[model samples]
Target: MSTLTRARRKLRAHPVAADAALAAGVLACMVAGSFAEPHGPEGIDWGVRTPDVLSLVLMTLAAAALAFRRRAPRTVLAVASGASVVESVTGDPRAPVAMCAVIALYTVAATTDRPTTWRIGLLTTTVLTGASMAAGPLPWYAQENLAIFAWTGIGATAGDAVRSRRAFVQAIRERAERAERTREEEARRRVAEERLRIARDLHDVVAHHIALVNVQAGVAAHVMDKRPDQAKEALAHVREASRSALGELRATVGLLRQSGDPEAPTEPAPGLDRLDELAGTFRSAGLPVEVARGDEGAGLPAAVDLAAYRIVQEALTNVRKHAGADARAEVSVVRVGPRIEITVLDDGAGQDQDHAPGGGHGLLGMRERVTALGGTLTTGPRYGGGFRVHAILPVTTRTSGARDGRP
Candidate 1:
């Protein structure tokens, strides 16, 4: 960097040393000004008369006090003003000790509030100007007395302006930083939500088709030698289930492809219209699912349709996996006013239906889907025998404004 820039950075880093250097500079100026005579035959004359020993001593004390201006501004101003007053009363031509007081006043104003700056600035101006006017050998109306008042006023005003500019810049910096943090937080939240949506889709597809494949494979193994024809049919069913699983998995994973990748599947998501086909797959897997529709062909929102379809799919998968072989599940979809209701009931009487083979996230996933679309789900064991899954969804999805329109 440039030499001037490096010096400024060092001054800011070591303020005590910078203050001592400033005091030396101010002392030099004061000693030089002491011998100058403004009223000489020439416009002004330097080294016309030397200052007394007492005036030199007072000027030294005032400059020394200024070295501590930043640490104790009020105390420095008091000391500098007192020295200036002593020089004003006794010296024939007063030394410029009051220059130190002006610098001290500026420091105080820049570090303090406006009210405190005004009070201290006015007090320093009155004391120094009044001392020069009332007791100096020069007349009360001399220009030197008035000059002290004008310089002190300028110093205070300039300092207050600097403080205001610094504060404004600081406020703008803080606001920009807060905005950046908020944007990062929002992006993270969207990533988390998208991950959850993809997880649910994968689980529903894998669970439904894999369960069928497992059942058909077992049947094929059991009948391999005794019943060759039945075994062949079972193997065929396994191939069909695996094929379906692959198609669904491909479609689900396609969603993660970037814009530059090959185009993804555009097929509409499954809904109530696919109920018959869904039942046929389960029937072939040895679970009898009976579907009933009571709503006279009314349209449903895309989110609601997908949620309804998944809920039925998950509930039936659970029945086939946990319920006894003979268990029969009944699924019903009915539209009532502004809402559509779906119910799945199974009379399974199987082992503890509360827990599935590998820990059950099926119920939890279903609940999250329903809740996202502002719907409600109730699932538990029926009183007499099996399990029941009931869900009520608004025909027109009423998602919270915060949702990212995942469906």
Candidate 2:
């Protein structure tokens, strides 16, 4: 990396001592320059003054502070401003003594804000210039006083320009950082939304089909001792339900796996063609299930067919579970205009209905599934004393299109 980066990372590699030695050498030169001449004004003391040694010591201290000025600007400025005031009031030539003050002013302007620099710079210049003219052995309009004014102003102005540039760069960095954060947040939100959509699909498909399987298994075990033909039919229903569940589950899960990793297993989803076999499953379980079709042999979108089959299957299962043992259920599949309406009705008081149509997540899953296909679902107690579940699923499944909802 760069030298500054290496030095910042490793504290021991700093050049503080080397810089201090260099500043000391420069200070020595300035001290020597002050003693060489005193051309402060035309008629002022042109040679060395009486208090030259003390003035040299003060100027030397101010110049020494320059070594640490970059590290601690405020401290360096304080020392340099003090030194300038002393020299303007005591030294023959304000001379090289004001050099340290100029460096410190520049450091302050570059590091601090304009308002703070203005306040401190004006104060330093005012104190030093006024002190040199009012207390020094020179006239008020001496060249030394004019030189003090010019040098101090240069230090403050140059430092302020450097400060402005640094502030501008920092602002640009902050704006880029903010935009990056917003992009990351948007990406995270999209990921979460996709995951939820996948999960809802899994829950609806698995819960509906698996419940049918469980109900079929129970029926086979219960009637196996008495009715051989009915028990065999119940077992057949169990096989159909399990096989259907496994197929849908595999296809739904495959959509999520990475394409390059490995091939995803899939099985075709059941549609309206399976409706007769599904209705037979409930009839074989000792519950009377009657189906009447009014679709006129029309084919629906695969998603609509699947949603309609599940809605009817779940409703019939609830009838067998909650309705009285004597209850008879009706299943109707009808095409009404642009929608396919499939409804299940049981003539048993649902209060005794251990498996009402809207219990648990079955009905909720049905509603979500139908709605996703751009349809409507309504389930509740029938007006008199039964339960009814009606779902209107669209022939053209809207969710199948990418434009249905964009991530």
Q: Which candidate comes out best when scored by lDDT?
A: 1
Which regions of candidate 2 deviate over 4 angstroms?
1-29, 32-51, 64-76, 122-195, 265-359, 363-407
Under the 3 Å rule for N, CA and C atoms, how many clashes does model 2 have? 5
Q: 97-147 in candidate 1: lDDT tens per residue?
A: 889889998998999989999998898888888889998888889898899
Lowest lDDT 10-mer window, candidate 2? 398-407
Assess every candidate by TM-score: 0.89, 0.64
- For residue 163, what is the lDDT in candidate 2? 91
lDDT of each: 0.89, 0.77
lDDT string, candidate 2, 1-407, tens digits: 99987866564455577547657876876766665445556644534544367776886788788889778988988887787777766656544677787778888899889999999899878887888889877898987788888888988999899899889999989989999998999999999867766776677566656666777787788889999788888788778877867877888888888969577775556676887887776676567888899996887767787778778877887777677678899999999887899989999864633353555666666777777677888888888888899898777665444444533
The TM-score leader among the candidates is: 1
Clashes of 1: 0
CA RMSD (A), model 1: 3.1
- True lDDT of residue 96, candidate 2: 68
TM-score of 2: 0.64
